[model samples]
Every structure is written in structure tokens, then in C-alpha cells.
Target: MDRQDAESAVRVLSGYPTEEEVAALIAVLAVVGQAARAAPGPEAAGARPGRIPAAAFAAGYQSPTSWQAS
Candidate 1:
């Protein structure tokens, strides 16, 4: 989504957002959507083969916790 649309979505979801927050939110959404599209799934049409390793996941969660989260 464009910055204005993203900001409007944030406002609809969480009330209101400052200009800086909106920009950050837009960036975050872009990155997150990129990552999600890159992840292994039926929805990941045209994605490369093989699973993305757990290490490729955000670093906070341990492998064991990730297994449990699945």
C-alpha cells in the first residue's frame, strides 16, 4: 500500500498515528509483506523451493520455541 493508505489503515486499526509513526508503519508493512511472501506456503506462488530455515526467522525465538509455535 502507499504511505497514505498505510497510514489510514493504521489509524483504522489503532486509532491515530503521527507522521513519523505512519512512515515507520509503512516501512514495516513493506518489509513484513516481503518476508511473508518469501516464506514457504501454498500462497507463496513463484517462491523458491525449500523451507526457509528457522534461523531466517526473526532472531528472538529459539528453535525449540519455534517448533512449539508451529
Candidate 2:
């Protein structure tokens, strides 16, 4: 959406936002949505019952094997 449209939506959704702040907030929201969608299923499940970590967080931080040189 354009600057004018985002600003109007922000006003209705929350309150009036300045031009610069509105633009930045829109960009931030986009990134947040992207990350949420890209997150792994278990990691995104949060504190729901019956869920447990399959691996330690430290062990989970692995480089993309597909990108490594053979």
C-alpha cells in the first residue's frame, strides 16, 4: 500500500501517525509477518500443551547444508 493508504489505516486501527513513522511501521509489520510465516512449525507453536523441543536451541543453529560447497 501507498503512504497515504497506510497512514489512513493506522489512524483507524490505532491513531494518527506521522508520515515517516507510518512508513516505518508498515515496513516493520511486513518483516514481522514474513518471519512468522517462515518460522519452523514447532518453533512457532509457542507454549501450547503436548509440545516439546525435539532438539536443543544450540544444536538447532546449523548452517544451511545445501549452500555448503561439496
Best by TM-score: 1
All models: lDDT?
Answer: 0.72, 0.69
Report the lDDT tens digits of candidate 2 across residue range 1-70. Answer: 9998876677757876677777877899999999988877653666555644445435764445734853
Instruction: Tell me the spans in candidate 1 whose CA falls farther than 4 Å from its real position.
Output: 1-14, 43-70
TM-scores of all candidate predictions against the true structure: 0.39, 0.38
Error of 2 at 9 (Å): 16
Error (Å) of candidate 1 at residue 42 is: 4.0
The true-versus-predicted C-alpha distance at residue 25 of model 1, in Å, is 0.5
Give the deviation of candidate 1 from the true structure as CA RMSD: 10.6
Displacement of residue 46 (Cα, Å) in model 2 is 13
